[model samples]
Target: TLSQHPDKNLHKIAHTRSSTGPLAERVRPNQLCDVIGQESFLPESPLGRLLVEDNLPSLILWGPPGSGKTTIARIICRVTKRYVVKISATKAGVKEVRIIIEEAEKRCALCQPGTVLFLD
Candidate 1:
């Protein structure tokens, strides 16, 4: 689990060299402080404070290509101990979303970690 205090862990996320993915995924920042260019979302910042206090609320992150939007969402999930369900809006239709929501509901009923839908 991540430390609630944002200033503490300014280190990179640990992963094995065997992990395979796109370059961005391989190099993604696991810690909030390790994320660059989005200081407003850092733990010391207001938004970061809100996240620490209230947990993650529904949000639509907008940024240019290669920005840290996906990384931020995944980090939030880790911090909150939630399972992330990533889907691209262009590929997933309403039925697919409904299916995810239903599965999430089932997980919630089983007292599992809540789901964080990361619609890209």
Candidate 2:
């Protein structure tokens, strides 16, 4: 059934919003260029310059609740085009972390590219 749909129609359907999504989800930046504030840590900054050169690193972003830690992580994953495996520290346990690590390892072993494990 999915294969029967036209590609153009599928694109339109994918972009259509349900209107029930959270305000944050609705306004979230889809690209790094759209993200405002945090000028000192963006791609033009010293830290960002280093990250741009080496996108694969275990990074820890600590900030207040609304300070865009998640946003920055999403942008990093997007810019690098790396697979993202998100896990909330409040909800996930060691077993979940181990599974994610195993999956990431498997992806690496297959030469399928690396992943960004975003611990929210």
Q: Which candidate's TM-score is highest?
A: 2
lDDT of 2 at 68: 82
Every model: Cα RMSD to truth? 7.4, 9.2
Q: Model 2 over residues 1-120: C-alpha lDDT tens digits?
A: 323655444334434645577646655665554567877556777767765775556778898888888888887876776678888999999999999999999999999877888998
lDDT tens digits, residues 1-120, model 1?
223436443223323433566545655787788888999888889889877874666778899987888888888877776778989999999999999999999999999977889897
* Residue 19 alpha-carbon offset, candidate 2, angstroms: 3.2
List clash counts for every candidate, in order.
Answer: 0, 0
